[model samples]
Target chain A: MKKLIMIFSLGILFLLSACAGENSASGNSSQSTGNKNSEAGTKDGKQVVTFWHSMGGAGQETLNSIVEDFNNSQDKVQVNAEYQGTYDESLTKFNAVAGTDSAPTMIQTFEIGTMSMINSGNIIPIQEFVDKDGYDMSGLEGNITNYYSLDGKFYSMPFNSSTPVMYYNKDAFKKAGLDPEKAPETFEEVEEASKAIVKSNPNMKGFALQAYGWLWEQLLANQGALLLNNDNGRTDTPTKIGWTEKEGKSIFEWVKRMVDDGTFANYGTNGDNMVAGFLAGDVAMFLQSSASARDVIDNAPFEVGIAFLPYPEDQERQGVVIGGASLWMIDGKPKEESKAAWEFMKYLQTPEVQAKWHVGTGYFAVNPAAYEEDVVKEAWAEKPQLQVTVQQLQSTKSSYATQGALMDMLPQGRKIMETALETVYNGGEVDQAYKTAVQQFNDAIEQANKARKK
Target chain B: MSMNPTLETNETYMYQFERVKKSARMKSFIKGMLFLFPSILLFSVFVFYPMFKTIYLSFYLTDAKGSTTVFVGLENYLNMFTNPIFLQSIKNTFLFVFYTVPPTVLISLFLAILANENLRGIGLFRTIYSSTIGISVAAASVFWLYLFNPTMGLLNKFLEAFGGEPVGWLTDPAWALLSVSVTTIWMNIGFTFLILLGGLQSIDRSLYESAEVEGSGYFYKLRRITIPMLSPTLFFVITVSMINSFQTFGQIDILTQGGPANETSLIVYSIYREAFVNYQFGSASAQAVVLFILILVMTVIQFKLGERRVHYQ
Candidate 1:
């Protein structure tokens, strides 16, 4: 009798679920909700486009205002902007729709997924789009432009790009008897400093690298680790992984030392926790995306110092990879929608907007033109900390480590490396784990590739 | 009609056969609708339709130029099982279930019995015992993670106050799964407690009195009368708990994230990583199917074992 009732209730529940509306993946679908005026294109033969991005804060507001300006200025094209969730979620959701022909006209993708998006053939090549629309990207930031292009073909419109930097707590450093102004310049120095700082103050920690393998990847790239050996540096073939090189070994050794010493901890394995620990004075230093500086300064209880990542012992840096995402244009959207999206994309690259984004959030302005403009120069003139990110941008070069990795199983690879690090850090063998992980990851890649083949 | 008994008999036999056939058909139809309703509705809405679509899409390659999905079958599943990460995920899931299920079942049953006393302020005790149910898994996991922080968690704080060194609650590979299981047990105890409580309340008082008349003590009475009588509810709770533990995702996602060496990655969490995170929907669906079968087998085993113990009065 009880089991009958159980079956009966479950049946009813299932029936009801069939009628219930689906979850619209709430995060991305409504970030920048605007007035729903028309499902139709623009009036007077104009092209109306829908653009989606996850840029929030002043940058989001600025993008909205620019869109409104574009809508007002051109009767030929009306741009409607929408906000998706963070870059990663947005790309995944976009692909699900894009797997069919129903994709947003334009969507944002992280730098890591750029080659994958290009290889997928679903997104429109920006070079083609620009050629057809006759839009010049000459006014955009020169360095920002460098990261977005592939083989002289601009596949994405770069926006809101930032690099990772060290965020330190001055108060914790002072308590630990370490000079807050002098940042560690190498991995060995960081290790020794961390041990000293940890001893000096119970609450103070010397180092907390946010993404273990992710940081390692960056460090290796800056230390001249080639992410891929072929495919014209992430242009031709996409889906090759190269982590068994000298770079991989060094990174493992460095991380294993930190884990053994207990100076670094990431239970959730997220940068947010590291930031939280730093802000709460549990840790003295953090290496995270430069964009997070403002939020840390605002929420932090002590003076926060920002600095460059420690150079590897080899010392000749290959330059840092650009973190954050870019926007990909879809090929099949209505002309009006594509035009509106293009206009919105161009509007975000303007000097005034870039400068405001740089100042409001710690993400440096990508536009070189923005820095030369009086307004942008003046904004940074009084505030030099904001300039640190841009200054690093000057030293930044386009490399596989700092720029991106072109592997089909990177989303999977991240887990592989994370688990390997955790195991090694917890006193597991690094060499054995790496061999096992690489073989497993390659098998996964072969599987994905085979699925793709089928 | 009485003129010829044979004619009457023949007519009655045909009528009876027709009636019986009609009844059988109607019975089967109603029962079929009842059973089919849940599975069809759920499969169409949640599991089935999505799976059918996902499997259909497993074929074809994706590239920046375009996404072309061809019709492919079995390839995705074959690839998944062959992959070491996926295989390791399987091993880890089983390892977790091994540690979690037995401890949770035994401890929860004990807790239910202890709290079943007819004492003062029993309501307060019940509330305290079952309160964690109200907490969201994600929210509970966050608290659990903080508690397991090796350097400065509540667990370490207490341990240190006793002049003992801190143990890695969720950090060490050996301890990670145990730590996650501990949180799962605490969070879910309230649910099974309420189940056993209802069963305990429903047991007849007359039976106990009869046992007392027979000179049976509390232990003997509990072992003979209560255990046998409560077997049905126990069977149900155990089955549900097993299934729930197998599908465990929240704690792993939030607390350990299937780490300290994938020590806590359950099948469902792996499915999430494959489908949502890696965009390998086809492979993920295959995993979901495999998981569904594993749960079905376990549930069947529980029912088979239950038959011997259950007494339907």
Candidate 2:
């Protein structure tokens, strides 16, 4: 028994030391890796700026090239970009690293996270940096900046801005005997065209819509409708969602009628499925982010056309809200490092870099001057589908509703909206679904407010 | 050198011996601890610490950064219980378990029996039966996602050929949970089959031979000899399958995203959404604690029930 006890205790001690060694070794390795980059930058008295972003695939490649160009443009700073998964995941990680020494100097947060990041009090408003440096802000697009600003002051720099657009199979339209070049500009026209397409091919769905909340939000904005109270959550905290209003009901009822008529297929909440449907010729047309234009063009078997997101016949188009992410400089970092990050941000907004980004990734160039760049003009001349997104942004009406909703619980609100949409699509009563979703949103906002107070 | 050396006293000798024994024991104890230290430390750091932290955080309200700002004892739990979504998630989790466990055990047991035969090419059959075990949850879910696609999926195509309508395998709430459960059942069969096969191989051939000699039919022999002997493996498979079904997330995330009116929203998915999406770490931790307790109670019940019915022989 004594011998057994001795063995057990010895075993425990061995485990303890092993764990300690492992932990320290990991710590050393991470520290060494971090030190290597900063060391290179520090040797030349250059500030090192660490940037965390959520771009992946080709977008990541383009972003890396842009960062490389910025690093080589001058000797004052070195920028290192890191891919940190999806937008939601990146924001979650950013929040987790807040107050920690390991926080990145800069982060790219999705547009929906704007209010949350602002409320966190962990970021330096981009407007402050712009004012301090007296940077040329006139070159940036007014509409893109409108989404990122609060009361005419920008909080973050718009990086990869996108708006929802209609993607259609040109061949499908031709087969249905509809004018291939003429795209539907109103919801009623889209419904009528869908019926013609379905009548042409029984096996094909006339239209498919992704059940994403962003799409619904964009629809509301196009109708000049608010998503939340307090003027789209711009002035103060929103206590209730605006989805119970007439515009919201009309959107739901339109979708339900489409589905009921077998003209529209609901692909659930994944936007990729709708994109896939359009590419595979299973659907005549679909609504998706302009950012997806590259993927669709690369994969679609037929000619694809892009058009503006449809609005109701009676409601004037108020433009769609941006769908992508923006760059926010983290607070509490060294002032020089923050300035270095700001310089990189400025580089990203230059006409040449923005043109490269727009041409490469199919995202809207935040800088309006980028459209005049040779690379951008040539790419648009070759693929005019890219020009449609630019035109949509330029033509959008500047209004509080069009500026987009600002809510700390926007992610949760979007999730609830998607759930309510799914409920309606599944044959549940629209009023019941909207009521339950709104109540949940109100509860979430209340809880968030209470937590913020604490 | 030893000429005038006195003999040691008995008490002194015994005392010296006791000291030497004590020292040796102490050295061995240190050695044992040294051997076990790494495992104990790892478990304490990765498992126990996180568990204790979860319990502690369950009582506090957390902010966007997941920092605890205020403590409201049991408020998180109370709110979770009152939330209809949470209650629905609990029900859905239970439904997933009920839909999965029995079918998994029965089908795998049947497959194991078929594969346990001493025939040529049995290895190939066993390999075929157990191939799904090699596929990770993410990979299997992707495969199922394609198979569940409403328009172009193979499953719907097969159904359409049988004169049935193309059902929305993933879209309709009525069929979403069942669809995900089907995928889970398919994934679990490989593991359960392997366990049951091992159990079947271990059962003595004499028992079955005796039953055969008594002119028992195949069903009779299976029920009387094979089943009773396979009770232990069945118990293990059921317990593991139950636990796995309760924690199902990847498939639900990929295939349905806990959607179609939250029909497939299990407890683990709810906890994830609460923590990551809503940044409600306190409520998420509370949900986690509840899940932990539930799993513990379930495991205890399984063990207690198995103790009575599981035949060691």
List, for all models, the DockQ compared with the true complex: 0.30, 0.29
Count of backbone collisions in candidate 1 = 21
Best by DockQ: 1
- The list of candidate 1 runs beyond 4 A from truth reads A1-51, A55-84, A99-105, A132-134, A169-180, A231-235, A242-244, A261-268, A372-383, A398-403, B1-82, B114-121, B143-170
Off by over 4 Å in 2: A1-48, A71-78, A334-336, B1-41, B150-152, B156-165, B212-215
Query: lDDT of all the models against the reference?
Result: 0.69, 0.83
Under CAPRI classification, how is model 2 graded? acceptable
Question: At residue A81, what lDDT does model 2 achieve?
Answer: 87
| Candidate 2 lDDT, A1-454, residue by residue in tens | 3234335433443343223223124334434444465445454677888888889876898899999988888998988887777888778767766755567788899998998898889999999998989987877888887888788888998889989999998999999999989999998989999999999998788877777889889999999898888888888788777544678888787878788888987778867666766776778989888887877877888999999999989889989887799999888877888888998998898989999998888898999888889998899878889899989988899887888998878888888889888887877788888778778878988888777773
TM-score of chain A, all candidates: 0.85, 0.89
Task: Tell me the deviation in Å of residue A162 in model 2.
Answer: 1.0
In candidate 1, what are the lDDT values of residues B132-165, reduced to their tens digit? 8798888899988888876557898899899886
Q: Which lDDT tens digits does candidate 1 get at residues A168-275?
A: 777777777788788776778778778878888755556776445556557767776655545324654544555445666776687678778877654436555567
* Candidate 2's TM-score: 0.88
